[model samples]
Every structure is written in structure tokens, then in C-alpha cells.
Target: MSMTPPPGWYRDPSYPLVERWWDGTAWTDHRRQPGSVPVPLAPPEPAGHGPDRARAVALVAAGAVLVTSIVTGVFVLGRNDDGGGAAAVRTTPPATPSAPSGAAAPTGSSTAAPHSGAASVVVDELNGITLSLPKGWVAPSDVAEDDLVMTTPGTYDCPGDPGLCRHGTVASRTVTANAERSPKALAEQDIDDAANTAYDRDVLGGRPYRGITSHRLLKAGSVAVAGRAGYLVRWRVRTGAGPGGYVESLAFASSVGSESPVIVRLAFDAGAEGPPLTDMDRITEGIRPTGDTDTGGGVGSSIGPSR
Candidate 1:
């Protein structure tokens, strides 16, 4: 019996409702073709690779839509005829030869150049002190600051108020002898001075040296920076000011090439009775140096002033 199919884009009833009798083949009209050759009736495309090929082609089209949307500063969404879901639109890329993997390299790309090597500094954190030095050798600290001779020997920075500053300890006036001193030393000196001058606290470690003084605080480990080695130190203390005024100190040491050693010291004081030790440990534990290569650079020695 002769029957009328649905009006628009319907497949013949004899076919699987997939082959279009209008063009007489599988659907290929992404756009209306005015007078092209009518597609001939053919067997349905094989199921497996056909779907995969269709997916790949859809991805390419999506990429093209995306580029166009980006250039126009607008978003464009699309969907397949199957009603799966909306998809990201993309702009078409310039045609290029496909590689064996069926993917094309980006056009107008330059060859990747090799990186140049710079003089490397390695940090080895030993015990509680950190040292920035060459690989496989102990770095030395001299008793002189860079060209600024210490008028008073062995004193670091002057002590500042703990309430006003992070490092609660005071430092004596001392010369930073070697330009190669790790960041740790300078921070220790600063902390010492802050504790001493501000709160009348004594320094457990002397300037550029360690002392066996009473410390509610401590330091240890190695923290590296930018392929250069340095160390980390953690310390804790209590103050007589606010209710349970406790202070925690942690320092990151990194040797800046030819520049003064960069010491990042962090301190937190909640009260005179908080868990300064716990806080100190937590902060110091999070210090990790980035951009370090495996030339064996790191904190190699204990965290403390070398005897």
C-alpha cells in the first residue's frame, strides 16, 4: 500500500528510517546544497567506525566554533541531532597535513630552544640551621657584613618589640661577613634582636652562631629556592604581655645570586598561652623550595649556627 511519510527530512519507510530518500543516502547536508549531485542510495554506514569518525569530525567543528566565539568575545553552544546534549562550539583551524596519529601540530610554531645553565647554589639544612653553599661542600660564613663593617662585633640587627614585630627576639649589632650566608642566619639575627630589645628576652643562639640558651622556640630542616639551596628554622617563645602571649617563628633561607641572602621569617602570636611550638612546627613544615634541580641541592646540615 502506498503511504505518505512525514513531511520534512524523513527516511523512506522501506529503509531503516536513517537513509534519506530525498537525497537517497545517509545525511551529509550540514548546509543546504542548491544543485549538487543527488546522493545515491547506498547501504547504511557501518556502525562502529562510523560513530567514531562522526565524533572526531564533530570535535574539529567544535574547535572551530570555539575560536570564533573567543575572537568575538561571546559564547556559542551547539547540539547533535541525537539530542545528546549541548556542546562547546569551536572555530575552524587552518587545513594542515595530519600526522600518523591523525592529529596536526600547531602551525607557525618555533622549535623549542634549550635552557642555559646558571651558577647553582645548594642548600643543605642540618639539625636546625640552614646553609646555602656549593654542592658536596660545607658553606662558610665570615664575620663581616658586605662592605658595611660592623662597628659592634657579633651583633645582628637591633632588637625590636615583639608586640610590634613578628620576630620577638632582639639581635645584637653584628657584621654579616660573607655575602654567601644563607637566609637563615640573617633571619636569626633579626629575631634575636627583636626578642632582646623589645621584650627583654635572651637569644638562645648568638649572632651567626648558636648558643645553648633557653628557648621556647626551635628551628630545623632545609628549604630551597630557585635551584639554590637554603635552610629552615623553627622556634617558639612566650611573652609577658597579653593573655598567654606566645610567639612562633619560622624562617626560610635562600641565597640570592650575588644579592643579599633572602630570609623570609614568619611569626604568629595569638596570646601568651597559645601552642607556639605547634604553630611553629606547622608553619615550618609547609616550607618547600621550588625550581630546584636534582643536582643534590637542599638543606644538608642541621638547623643551627655552625660552631
Candidate 2:
């Protein structure tokens, strides 16, 4: 027989000074990794896993030194009409496994619309999509029709009672659809421009990437998506630690339709800690245009990210 750790933040078994989420049931996507704020302890548990998030540059080997100039050179420009809190999986990307030192990232059992802090399962009706989201991962009220933002649940460094995670999009996800480059090129470009470097340094830090180590494209290749062309990438970047972000990302993109060159993506901040995500690939692979994208074809149809 096995004993499960009580629901709360605990010291990540893999990394020191990190915290993980155990929502009274299973491990979650929340982490308090290497460079997060003063790690807060979870409900009566030790700091078993920390909650930290990261992002960076392009085409460089994972975790190598990258110059800010290079990031600016090939970085994807322009932001889509986004809601906020972008987050990741597939091949799937590499990550610390699930917790209680053994359990896996749990699959939610809710089929109803999310309310407050319960686990939510939301479907994009216009797109024929189904998302098995974490508790509090609900579409934002101000979300655009083409974009989606969900409330991420995790224990933050904030002093709080036990068995609770008040953190929302501080480490969140943004999924949007539009005519960007193809999945391959767009995956490469998204890293350099914002996802890894700028978003962390400029936007979050009120400055620029410290350029300690070059952001890394750990892996990139093709995936099998249902009704669309799919490409997957794994990025290793330390977007905010001023050195190397203790972050791991698994980004997936799809070029829908045979007429136009359009791309849809699952993007976000994932920490390099235990209790990693599960079933994310199935979620990404299941995406479609709600019908069909009348694209022009080819991976070079556009210049930069959609404005």
C-alpha cells in the first residue's frame, strides 16, 4: 500500500527550494521552482515542490548563451488579440513527472462549466474543441472569440492558509488562432521574440533579457493532429532568473486548411519542477477551425506574429 501526501504545497522531490501543488487529490501544473519569489509552504506540508515559471531566444542549443541582439534579430513580432496567461505539451515535451513523489498529473472529472475554484472542463463550441483544464482554468470574461485565457491554480509565495492556491494567471496560458507563419517556422520564431525572452525580461521585469544563457529549442518536429498539420517544439529557457530560467515549455502548432497559411498554438510558462502536465497533447491535437481554414498554403505566407 501507498500513502498519499495531503493536499497542499510541498517541497519538490526533484529540486531544492521549489514547491508543487497537490489539490487534496493529485499533482497539478503549478510549480515554485528555482527563481520564484520566497517559496511559500503548502498546507502543513514541507516544501516538496516549488512553483516557478520561465521563457527565451531561438535556434540556439538549449541552455546556451544567447545575445540580446540575436533574440531581436529573429524574434517574432506583434501580439495577437490575446486575453493573457499563455501556457503548454506533446512528443510530448519533457517535464518533471507527477507527485506525492509518485502520483501523476490528474485528469479532471468535471464536465460542467467552472465556477470559483473547482476543476473546469470547457469546450470551444465555435471550434469543436474540448479542454480538460485545471481547477480555476476558466476562459476569461474578456476573452476574444479567437483567443482563450484560463485561470491557473497554484500556491504562490504569498503567505496563505494551507490547502489553497490563490495564484491565477501569474503562471498562465494564452491560446490564439490566426494567420501567422507555419507551425515549424512560427514555433522557432515565437521563442526568440516574446515567449522566452521579451515576455520575461521586458514585460515582466520592466527591462530586457539579461542574456546570460541563450534560450534553447530543445526539440522540434512534426506531430499527428486530427484534421490539421501539426508541429511540436520543446524550449528550455530561464526567462527571469537573470541567469537561466528554471522553465520548460512544450509548444504545439497547427496549420489548418489547404487555402490559407494559419497557425494556432498552446503557449505558456512552465517551471522545471515535478508534477508536470498530462493529456496536453491530446488537447492540442484535437483543435480544428470549427470547420475549415481557407488558407493560401505554405509556411512562409506571413512575416511575423499576427498584429
Candidate 3:
């Protein structure tokens, strides 16, 4: 006997947007309350004769009223099949439960799930080149064997002749020392004296390699590496193709944690035309001491001898 609105009726549009009432087959005065039961319309009188006809009419009217109420509620709930109703529903998705106060939202489905865009830093034990790589990046065995490392969108290729390596190429080399040598002396030898060196040249996959023209020093800094004091020097150099291509070279040296007295790293990049200082900072930041090191390494090593 509850009275609900007809198929389409609105009592208030700005606030609660309440619905009007329906009485059997027509509108009625049975008003609805905020939390009270709805009142149905007055019933029809009994007809003459058997009274069966009146009962049937009344039943039909009641059925119509119930059906109209259901349809009206569904339409009001924004579940109508009309295009506008669908659009409204889409714009207003189901409300999401709020998280408890001061609790961080859950991360990446589960703790086991790897975070998107997460990069793991891997340091090469031999050359000490640290690579920041995504989970999917494949580390080639050959480069690992050669003590060379690179990130995705990059690959390391060791040449029988490293001097002829191509553009965008990065290369490194090892050198021997007479005695325990500090990183500063080795860096100076590589940059100023050009001794015990490795060079990178420009080469495209299917194109001939180009030659370098001039080499100029840009910036120099000192950092610790692998439990020993180290020095880092960067340089800007010209290429063989006239005034276009350039090269960046970073050389680092440090004692190899009680293994070797000193370990030297000479990294070069071909086809880099920017100021030498830019790549210098990048390569310097990549150098990290594996163990505790002296703050300043007691000044740079003298250039007297390799030892």
C-alpha cells in the first residue's frame, strides 16, 4: 500500500529531489516523509451484482501503481535505459570507500609485485661501472665477461681494436701500476700525458666510423671509489668530421679494496657535442666508494712514478 511517485515526477529539484505520489492509476495526495512509510490512495467501492468486476478493476489499478512506482524509482536512481541516463551514470561512478585516517594507500597490488618505473642499481665488480636499469633490461653475458656494463636502449661491444669504436660508444680499459698508486696521479696521467689510455670513436651500425679532430679538457673533480681515494677528470674533444661531432672522456682511479693497489677507469663517449662539464658530472656521480674512505685522500698523488 506504499505510495511512490508516477513514472516521472519530482517534488524538489534543488535539494533532496523528492518524488511525488501515485494512487492506483492516477496522482494522489499521499505525501511521503523523510523516514516514514508512504500512504496509499483510497480504495475503490464495491460494484453491484457479484462485486467481481469491481475487485478486478481495483486489482488492475494496484498492479499498475506498483509497476509505475518501480519504473519511476529505477529512472530516478539513474538506471534508465535512455542515453542521457547512461551518460549521467558514467559521469557519476559508484562511490569508493575512503581509507582509514593516517594509513598509507596500498602499493602495487601486493608487496611482491615489482613497482612500475623502478630501477635497480647494479655495480660491475671488475670495472666498477654502476648501471641504473629497469627490471626487463637484459644484461649481456659477453659485456659482463669484458667488465663492461650499459643500460637499456644501449649495448656494450668490445672490439679487438677499441681505438676504432663508433659514435655513441662507451669504452673502458685497465692499467698496471708499479706500487700502491693514488687515484689522482692516474687521472692526471690519462688526461695530461695520454698514457695507458682508451679512446672511443664515432661509428654507426651500417656506416663507416669517423675520426676525432681535437681534444680539450673541461672539468676535474675528486671522489672516492671502492674503499680508496679516487680522481675523476672529464674532457671535451673534437672529431674527424670537421666541427660537428664531439667526444666526452671520464677517467677515474682508486685502490681496489686490498686486491689491487689501484684501479683505473677511463670511460669515453663518441658523438657527444655538449660542453665537457655536463657528462663529467654524470660520470662523477656514478662513482661511489664501496667502503669507507678518507674524506679528501690527503691531497692528490704526485706524478713522479706509476707506483
Candidate 4:
């Protein structure tokens, strides 16, 4: 009677330079280089003298004999062809991940060139703008359609709900729907929508902040962004749950020679755990045209201090 070999790594019939995992029943996809440390296998089932155990053993023995014969034949043939030595195995490397279905493939660099002098920056090719990433901030893993968004490094359980929440977020996008509106008009008009989107209900109908209870205008004034005239509106929003935060909408004309306006939205939770409120002004000061040489003019020309 043939005896079955226990589950272990064995010479791969297909690749002479590597060993494939055998689980007693069949070959697995897992493989490793020759002479490498073997992976631990599952412990064998306890032996028994029952009729069922005998039958199982008999079946396993038969299967093992067949597998051994096949593997021996392949190994002998490989050795004979190579004059008694292992043959080289060529493997194709994994391909890079492509964009998801229906999404445009990214073109050019996603990050701004280091000429801006900022420690780090994120480039929005669609809107032809770039925003500086603060020390504790990072580029978002996923961006909305036509919008560039950045947020603080980690997520936390939202105080109002069980959903994931970030302490701070800054989003930039072109005002395509109403391109003709002035910067001041656009800033004033978009502040409420920005606040609602940030603290009220999310896109999936989940109330992360339990909805906004009240909001008061904190600052409204003209500013210069990327050397273009702009306007910003800030508001202190009180949510039905949590220690409500601040939101701001800044609108400016595109510096990419387009008549379209660009809007940067800001949101920050109010607490010691949240990002410093001063980062709002610093981020605003860091905004610039994608390829502009001068970074010091645009946001420094604010009419009043940011709160």
C-alpha cells in the first residue's frame, strides 16, 4: 500500500527553481525560492482505528501515489534536460493599479514642483491650482469628481455619530455651474452650502454632525489669490451634536487664464484634538497658480485678518 506524504512544501513541477505548497490534496499558489525556510503546515488529524478512518487513509494514500508519480516524472524530465540541475524560472512582475472604471486617467504630475518653497504641496490639474499641505495634513486617498481635497492625517469617531471623521479638511474646485458670478458674490453664496456639506448631512444621507443648529458669519472680506482678486466668507457653525466647528468659503478667479472662478472650502473641528485654527490662514497663503513663479503675493494681500 502506498503511504501519503504529509502536507508540506514540495518541488514545483512547473518551476524548478521554486517550491510550491502542497496541502495533501492539491498544489497551492503559494511558492518560495529553493532553500528558503519552509512554512509551517497544519497539524495532522489524530489517527484512529475506526472503519471511516481506514477508508479515508486508503483514499489519501491512493491520491498521494498518483500525485507522487506525476511529480517524479516531471522532475526526472527537467533534470535530464538540464544535465541534472535545476532550471531557471522567469516570472512576470505585477502591473501597476489603474484608475477605476469611468474615471479619467491622471496626466502629468499630481504634486507641485518644489519651486514653490513650501515644504509640500498638492496640485489640482483640473483647476490649474496648487495648495500647500500643512505639517499634519495629507493628500486625500480619494477625491471627488473635479475636486481636490486634503485633510488631517487620521480619522476619529465623530462625536455626533459612529461615522469616521477628520479634524480638518480643505477642498478646492472650479465654480463651473456659475462661472460668471463675481468672487465676493460666489463666496457669500457658497458659504452656507459649504457649511452644510461639512457639518450637516454627508453625501450618503448620514448626519455626521447631527445637522447644523445655527451658524453666524465670522468674517467676510476681499483677498488676493494667485494674484487674482477674490473674496472669502467665514462662519462659526453650531451643530446639533459635538463641539461645532468653523467653515469658510474662498472664491477667486482662476489664474490659469480662464474666466472660471475657483473656490477653496475649509472646515475644522473646534477642540484641542483638532488642527490649529491658524492653519486656515497658512493654507490660504499657500495657494498659488500651478506654474506661477511668485508665491508671496496672492494670499498675503488680504483686506482683513482671518479668524
Model 3 regions more than 4 Å off: 1-119, 127-145, 151-174, 177-180, 192-209, 242-279, 289-307
- What does candidate 4's lDDT look like per residue over 189-238, in tens digits? 88877888788875445677888999988888888887788889999999
Q: Which candidate number maximizes lDDT? A: 4
What is the full ranking by lDDT, best candidate first? 4, 2, 3, 1
Better of 1 and 2 by TM-score: 2
Q: Where does model 1 exceed 4 Å of error?
A: 1-188, 196-217, 220-228, 243-259, 270-282, 285-307
Over the stretch 193-250, how does candidate 3's per-residue lDDT look in tens digits? 2211223221111111233345665555565443345565555555333232223223
What value of lDDT does candidate 4 attain over all alpha carbons?
A: 0.58
- Compared with the true structure, all predictions reach lDDT values of 0.26, 0.34, 0.30, 0.58
Ranked by lDDT, the better of candidates 2 and 3 is 2
TM-score for predicted model 1 compared with the true structure: 0.27
Best by TM-score: 4
Q: For residues 53-145, could you state the per-residue lDDT of candidate 2 as single tens digits?
A: 111101223553322211111012223334322232111112222323334543321112224543334433322333445433444321111
Give the TM-scores of the predictions, in the order they appear.
Answer: 0.27, 0.39, 0.37, 0.59
| Residue 220 lDDT (model 1) | 48
Q: Over the stretch 214-281, how does candidate 1's per-residue lDDT look in tens digits? A: 34555544554334454554444444443222322223333323333443333333454222434333
Candidates 1 and 3 compared by TM-score, better number: 3
Off by over 4 Å in 4: 1-119, 142-146, 305-307
The lowest-lDDT stretch of 10 consecutive residues in candidate 3 is: 70-79
